[model samples]
Target: MRKVSTWEVLFVPLFFLLILYPILAILGNITLEGMVRTFNDPIFWDAVKNTLVTAFFAALLSVLMALGFAYFYIFHPGTIIYRIADFMNDLPIALPHTVAGLALLLAFGRNMFGFAGPTGLAFTLLAVVLAMFFVSYPLAARTIASSAEEIDREMISVARTLGDSPPQAYRRVVIPLLGEAIFSGFVLGFSRSISEFAAVIMFGGNVPGMTQVLASYVFTKVEEGEVSMAVTASAFCILISLLLVLFLRLEGKLHARSEKSA
Candidate 1:
């Protein structure tokens, strides 16, 4: 028989309560009135719509880019081309979002090739999506690549031997095996894009009714001393993010169980 210390049980819950009580206290204090007003606010809907749009497209683009890089890395691991692609995918992780934003702004801003196109990507919703993609693609790529590593090369070889072309093998074998990882990557990318601050602000210019996302809206509200509104918005964001992360984790677990059963 093992003996337990009296402090262990009390200490664990107490530690968590100490950390979580303040947040719950704040949430409790925020009224439904603030939430209702936040929803009714014109800027709120704009930020919500823009944030969803940006997150969706950025996630889609990041998933595609990650899929491509993952495929190359997995199937062509011995090639110098694959090595270079891996390096490029990994580069963004170390690169600060601000530096990336600055580089993007310089490339697309009015001073340079701004003459090349009448409406450059600079300061547009498109810029927001692209910037989000740039910052998020690496996370997706790494996730997908790790999943790809777990797939059986022998299965792919057998499929190829059975007259499946490369593309066919990928569709039938790789895609099925990678569904969880790809889904995980998309979720991660969307989460990153939604929570992002500096990159989108700098690259997309935080223009209200144009490029302003939820995070920027929160920032604008806080800067303008709209304390209640800002707190409401921040709380809403926190709730949504927590729900999403929980959903993604549940989905991942279910998928893993299904895979195991099969």
Candidate 2:
């Protein structure tokens, strides 16, 4: 283990405090009464449900796609091919989410899809999912790629030598070694989808009871002078995000313990 530096010890806490003060302030403003009242509203339920559903599917799709890209780049026969693939994987990360959403809208918009707009796509949910997926895939691919790079190639070879096929070696040996990375990638991608405001708002049209998500719903509330509701909604979003982070940490600890025992 490395020793903690003085600058790291001091600056890290300050950085977190800067990040957390707003969340704390938002939570502080919300009364329990306000939370209850907000919860009673059907719109609240709709927004929360949409947020979860969209983020879940978006992260699922992103992680699955990332696996193929990462695997190929990590084990490609030629260095140039892997480098090109790696650069392509990272290209989307550099794109602004809002820009990505606009591109999706243009590519799959009313003119293209031959419908009214995002609302009339052959599948209505496609717009939102594409928007979320566009911005999140890079995080997932990068996470898996980083983990794969650290793994000893000989371990994979040993599995192959034990009569495992190439695909079997990956499924049984590679995936288990990269479990933490996959989970972390899922968390990152999920968080990005949850926080997505500009992309979904633009591409999905921010429709109430339809395309509206938690972040957008909170923005709508604030714009409508529903400060109490907005604060409560923001609180819930923050709480859920924190819970997910806690779960990740706990799961990581269990994995560490199991590895130690092994």
TM-score, cand. 2 = 0.86
Weakest 10 consecutive residues, lDDT, candidate 2?
117-126
Please provide, for model 2 over 1-262, each residue's C-alpha lDDT reduced to its tens digit, 9 standing for 90 to 100.
Answer: 9999999999989987998777789988998877887899898888888888888888989888878776786567377766776777767778777787777777787768865654345225567777787788888988888888888999989998999887788888888888898998898889888888877877876778888889988999899998998999999999998988898889889988998999
lDDT of 1 by residue, 114-212 (tens): 775654678888889988998899899999999898888999999999999887888889988898889999999999889887889988878877789
Top-lDDT structure, candidate number: 1
Q: lDDT value for candidate 1?
A: 0.86
Clashing residue pairs, backbone N/CA/C < 3 A, model 1: none
Candidate 2 Cα outliers beyond 4 Å, as residue runs:
1-17, 77-82, 115-123, 160-165
Best by TM-score: 1
